[model samples]
Target: MDIKAVQSSYARWAPVYDKTFGAITNVGRRCAVEYINSRGGSVLEVGVGTGLSLEQYKPDMHVTGIDFSAEMLQKARDKVQALELSQVEELRKMDARTLDFPDNHFDTIAAMHVLSVVPEPEKVMAEIARVCKPGGKVVITNHFERKQGVIASLERLFAPFANTIGWHSDFEIETVLQEDALTLEEQRALPPLGMMTFLVLGKSGG
Candidate 1:
């Protein structure tokens, strides 16, 4: 995938991103935040689009987010500033494939719906793993292209185009995490979007 093109496209769509995909279950957002909050320490959020997950995070928790698009970060900045969380939250424009943080620096790391858009999803996830503490968690969710069938066939046909516009690959959740040695702790499947799956994974430091 073209990173610049993806960034530009998201720059244009950042304004309406939340309202559109936001139509999906707020449950996922809430669950992600609560899970991170429960850890009670510094958090790193990759691809923090429009701050939809902010509503669920506690203001006391230290949170830092990074994204590839300054335009998207702009929308998120307003909310962080509005909530007086500027002290606790630092938003930076960055590429997920190469994170700037040191090893084992975060208590929790999240990449909600982020794996799909990057050119190298596995590399990004590995980077997420590298920054996370030995036992830290990585929360991820994406609408997958269902298993071999008519729907899957159709998705495969249009995948190249869909991918260009920031849609997900047909990757199975398990496959992505396997290379990083992360253990899945929970899973949630979105209704109607059978391909959509949410997972909470723990780094084994193995």
Candidate 2:
């Protein structure tokens, strides 16, 4: 998807996101956050739309979130204020392709159910690798296209509507795995018929 498509699609979905796509992706979010909480430290949460996972982060873990949508970020900000979540250090509007943070900044980075929605995911992944501290982990949860199955057929059917739907149904896992500095450490399928996947990639040094 292009930036305009992403922006417009999310602007439309932002109002009902928590009950719609957000609910469908809840398991992935929970699994990712639980794992991050276990490895508590400085975290950079990419695509932290509406801050749905913000409250679940352990209080001891320092968290910073970034998103491209102002509408979504506002909701996230409101949630942070209402809940008084002290762990959240900041939430900024940013493009994942060009993250504003310095190199080796965060201990962990989370990209939950968002790679397919953003433009230039490879560039985003490169930026993710660049900023993550060596030995830190990049956690991801996303729906990847199946090779052959009823799901694969369904994915093809919806592939054309990615811009309108706000996420690519045929998104490939390889798009996020090409960064040399990050090595795949774990991979697993998530619930709801294993449509979604959980991945952990460790940065190459400490």
Q: What is the lDDT of residue 31 in candidate 2?
A: 98
Each candidate: what lDDT? 0.77, 0.96
Regions of model 2 farther than 4 Å from truth:
none
Please provide, for model 2 over 1-206, each residue's C-alpha lDDT reduced to its tens digit, 9 standing for 90 to 100: 98999999999999999999999999999999999999989999999999999999999989999999999999999999999999999999999999999999999999999999999999999999999998899999999999998999999999999889889999999999889999999999999999999999999877
Residue-by-residue lDDT tens digits, candidate 1, 1-206: 67877887787778888878765746566667777888788899898878778657786788889989888889888887787664346889899999999999998888777777776877888898889898888887676667788878877777768535676556556556675457788887855555567788898863
Which candidate ranks first by TM-score, i.e. highest? 2
- Candidate 1: misplaced stretches above 4 Å? 86-88, 192-195
